[model samples]
Target chain A: MDYKTVLTTCTYCGCGCNMYLEVMDGRITGTIPCKTSPINEGKLCIKGWNVHEFVQSPKRLTRPMLRKNGDLTEVTWDEALDFTASRIKSIKEKHGNDSIAFLTSAKVTNEENFLLQKFARAAVGTNNIDHCARL
Target chain B: MIEEIKKQVRELLTSGTIKGFLGLREIDGHIAPYLFCDAEDMDSMNLGDYKKPGDARYPLNRILIHLLSHYPDEILGVLVRGCDQRGLNGLYSLNQLDPEKVIPVGIPCPPELAEACECSRPYPENRAVDGQAEGYSNQTLARIAGLDIGKRFEYWMNEFARCIKCYGCRDICPMCICRECSLECGDLVGKGDIPPENPIFHLIRAVHMADRCVDCGLCAEACPADIPLRTLYKKVADIVKKEFDFQAGYQPDAKSPLNVLDQ
Candidate 1:
C-alpha cells in the first residue's frame, strides 16, 4: 500500500541515466528507468537496473577488514587505516611506487575520485591510478 | 481524448462499478502510474503523454496483475493501448489474469506514436477515444530477414556485443512473469560474464518470448545497449505465426499454441 518511486540519476556510469527507485513499505525493491529523461529515454544498462540490489545486501562490508593469516578479520577504523598505511609504505619502499596501484569507483563522488588520484600521484608518488568505470 | 476517458471513469467510480481505475497521472510535471479511486482528481489523469505521445508507457497490465493479487475480489479498471489489450488477452489465455476480475478501457495511439512503435494494431477493440491510426508494416524484421546467414550472424553478434547483461529487457517485459528465470541459472548462463556468452543468452529469452510476445516493444526500449530487441522479438513472432499459424494475443477466444507449462 505504501509503494512509491523516487527519481534519481544512476551512479554506476557517466551516462547519468535517470531512474526511479521503487520503494515498497519503506524498503528499496526495484529500479524503473525514468521515461522523461533525454539521456536514457526509458532505458537502463545492467548496472543501472540492479543498482538497488546492493543497497541493503547482507554481503555488503559494513566494517573494514584486514587480512590476518589469510583470513579477512573485521577491525576498527584506526587499526585498519594504520595497517593500510603501513602496508602501502612498506610496499613503496620495497618496490617502486609504480608497482602499487589505486583503483577508484564510480559509486564515490568526483571529489573523492580526485582525492584518490591525488593520493596516488602526490602523496604516494605513483601514477598507477585507475577507475572501476574504466575511465 | 483524455476527457472522455476521464468522464467514463468518473461515472464508473461514482457508481461503484470498479474499486479503482489504473492509469498514468501527471504529478509535479512528471508522469507515473497511479490508481484513481472514487472522487479523486481527474485533472491529473493522463494518457501517458508526458513529453510526447506514448512516452510514459508503463506495464499497466503488469501493474494490474500485482494489484489484482492484493485485492482479489474487487474489479479494477485499466487503461489499455492496442498493445496492452493484446497483453491482457495473452495473460488471459495463460490463465495469469481472470478476465472477469478487471475491466479494460481502451484508447488508440496517436498516429505519430503508432508509426514510431511500428505497431500493426494501434487501436483496441473497445475504445474511449474515437480515432483511426494506421499500423505500420514490420520493416525491421524484414530488413533483418533480407540478410544472408553469415551477414545475419555478424549483424546479431555486433548488436549482442554491446549488451551489458543488465536484464532490463526481461525486467520490463510484461510477458516475463516467471518467478524462476533460466538466464539466472549459473549452469546454463555461466556467471559474472559480460555480454552473457553472446546469442545464447538472448536466444534463450527469444525462445521463451515466441508464444507470448504481444509486440509491445518495451523490451527494446528498455535495453540500454539499443540491441534492436524489437526486431529480434518480431522475428520470433513471425516464426511462430508461420510455423504454427498462431498470433499471440490477437485472437479473442483462442488458447496459447504452446500450453506446455500452465500457470
Candidate 2:
C-alpha cells in the first residue's frame, strides 16, 4: 500500500525533463512525465522515459574495482582512489600533461561535472576535457 | 463553465458521495491532474484550459486507473473530457475498472480544440457542458493510401526507421494495459538493435491497437520523433470496424471481437 510518486529531473541529458518516479514499497516501479513541468510539458524523450531502468539494474556497479594481475578485483574506496591517484601521477610524469584526457559522464549532476573539469585543469593541468554525451 | 464544474465537484465531495475527485488543479500557473480529497480545495480546481488542449490534456483515465487499483472499494469522482470518457469505457470493457465505483463528471471539448484533435466525437453522451464538432479527415492516412504497394512499403519503412525505440507511444496509450508487453519479447524483437527490425516493431503495436485503441491521440503527442502514430492506429480502428463492426469504447457492455472467441 506504500505507493508514492517522487518528482525528480531526468539526468539522461541537459533537457532536464521533470518526471515522477512511481515507487511501490520503496522500489521504483514506473516513470510518469510531470505534466506541470514547463521544460518537458508532459512529454519525455526515450531516455527520460526509461531513466529508472538503471537504478536497480543487476549489472550496475556497486563497488570500486581495480585491476590486479590482469583481473578486476573489488576494493575499498580508499584503496581504489589511492591506486587511481598514483597511476595518474606516474602516467602524467611519463607522458606529459597533454597526453592525459578527461572523459566525463552525463549521469552525474552539473556540480559533479564542474568538479571533474576543475580537477582536470587545476590538479592534472590538462586542457583535454570531454563528455560521454559528446560521443 | 469552470465554475459550474467546480461547484458540481464540491457538492460531490461535501456530500460524501465520493472519497475524492480527480481533476486538474492550477498550481504555479500550470494545470496538472490532482486528486482533490477536500471540498475546500475545489476553489483551486480547474476543468483544464480547453483553449490549449495540447498542453492542458493529460491521460486522466490512466491516473484514475492507478488510484482505483489501490482504492478498489472506494467510490471516486473523475473529470472526463470526451477522450478520457472513451478511455474509461475501454478500461471498463477490459475489466481494469469497475464502472459502478466511479462517477464521471464529463466535459466537452470546444469546437476549436476538437478540430485541432480531429476527434470524431468531442463530447461524452451524458453530462456534456459544450457542443460537439465534426470529425476531421486524417490527411496523412489518405496520403499513405494513395501510394502504391512498393511506395507504401517504402513510406512506412522510412517512418519506422526514425523510431528510437522510446516506447512512448505504448507508454502513453490508455488501451495498452497488458502486464506483459509482446513488443518487449526478445524472441520477436531482436535484442540490442535500435529502430527495432523495421516494420515489425511498428506493425506489432498497430496490430495490438486493432480492437483496443480509443484514438485519444496521446501516443502521437508523446512521441518525440513526431511519428504519425495516431493515423496508423486510426487505420487499425477502421479495419476493426470494417471486419468486426465493433468500435472500442463506444459501448460499455460489448467486448472487442478479438477478445471473444464466439463473436
Candidate 3:
C-alpha cells in the first residue's frame, strides 16, 4: 500500500536524464520520464521507459562467489578479496606488469570507476585500461 | 460534421432501439471523447477544427467495447467514420467485440477532415445510417510512396527519436490487446536510456502492426511527438496485402498472414 515515486537521474549513460522511479509497496515497478527535465524535454527513449525492470529482476547477482570444483560457491567478502589479490599477485609475477589489463563498466558510479582505474594503474602497474562502451 | 451526427443520434434515441450513444464533445475549445446517454445533450457535440484535429476512434472503440462487455445483450448506438468503422470491424474479426448488439451510425467525413486524415474513403462499408459526404482524395499515401527508402528511414528515425514511450499508441490502438507488451521485454529493449534501443521499439511495433492496423490514425493523434506511425503501419499493411493478398477488416473470413499457415 506504500506507493510513491522517487525522483532520480537515469544512470544508464552520461546524458543524466531526470526520471521518476515509481515504487509500489516498496518494490520498484516502473519509470516515468520527468516532464520538467531540461535535457530530455519529457521524452524517453524505450530504454528509459523500462529502466526500473533490472533493479528488481530475480536474475541479478547478489553475492561474491569463487569457483570450487568447477562450480561457483558463495564465499565471504574477505575470502573473495584475498583470493583476488593473491591471483593478481601471481599473475603479475608470472607475466610482466604491462600484460595485465583492466576494463570498466558504465553501470558503476564515476567515483568507483576512477578508483578502479587508479588501482589498476598504481597497484597492478598496467596502463591497458578500457571500457565496455569502447567496443 | 458532429452536428449532423448528433441530429442522426436524436432520431436513433427517439426510435427506442438504442439506450445510449457515444460521440465527441467539445470542452473548453478542446474536444474529448464522450458518451451521450441523453438525447437532450446533442448540442455539445462537435467536429473539431483542422488546427486541433484529433481522431478519437480508438478511445471510442474501447468505450464501446467496455460498455458492451459490461452490459451484455443490450443494444447501443455509436458514431463511426471510415477509420473507426474499420477499427471496429477489426475488433469484431478478432472476437474482441460482438457487433450484433451494436448499431454503428456512420458519419462520412467532409473533404476538409478527410484531407487532414489523408483519408482514402469517408464512408463505412457497413453503415446503420446514411451520411452526406463524398470520398476523399488520396495524395499523402502517394507522396509517401514516392519517397526513397533511405529518406523514409531517416524521416521515421527523426520522428521516433522524439518518442516519449508513453504507451499512448498501444493504449489508443483497438488491436493492441496483449496484457504484456514485447517492448518491455528485457533483452530486446534496454533499460535506463532517454531514447529507447534506437529504432528497435518502432520496428517491433511495426512488425506487430503488420496484420493488425486498419489504417486508423489514432496512433498518430495519440503520439505527442506527432510521429507518422500510422503511415508506417499503412505501408506495412499494403505490403502484407500485396504479398499475401490479405486485407485486414475486409471480411470476417479473411485470415491474417501472421496467424494462419501459408497455403
User: Among these predicted structures, which one has the highest TM-score?
Assistant: 2
For candidate 1 chain A, the 10 contiguous residues with the lowest summed lDDT are A1-10
What's the CA RMSD for each of the models? 4.2, 3.3, 11.2
Evaluate candidate 1 by giving its C-alpha RMSD to the native, one decimal.
Answer: 4.2
The top-ranked prediction according to DockQ is 1
lDDT of 1 at A53: 95
Per-residue lDDT over A1-135 for candidate 3, one digit per residue giving the tens place of the 0 to 100 score: 133456677776667776667554477865655544566534455556668988889987798999999999999999999998998899899998987888888777889889989999999988889887677
Candidate 2, lDDT over the whole model: 0.82
lDDT of 1: 0.86
Compared with the true structure, all predictions reach lDDT values of: 0.86, 0.82, 0.71
Query: Once model 3 is optimally superposed onto the true structure by TM-score, how far is the C-alpha of residue B92 displaced, in angstroms?
Result: 0.5
- Candidate 2 similarity to native, TM-score: 0.86
Ranking by lDDT: 1, 2, 3
Candidate 2's residue-wise lDDT over A1-135, tens digit each? 345557789988777898878675688867878766778777797788887888889998899998899999899999999988998999999999988999999889999999999999999999999999888
| lDDT for each residue of candidate 2 in B45-144, tens digit (9 for 90 to 100) | 7776733754566677877788789778888999887778877888988889999988999988777777777787777767735555566666667788
Fraction of true inter-chain Cα contacts (below 8 Å) kept per model? 0.63, 0.48, 0.04
Lowest-scoring 10 consecutive residues by lDDT in candidate 3 chain B? B49-58
Off by over 4 Å in 3: A1-135, B1-4, B48-58, B126-148
Q: 1 or 3, which is superior by DockQ?
A: 1
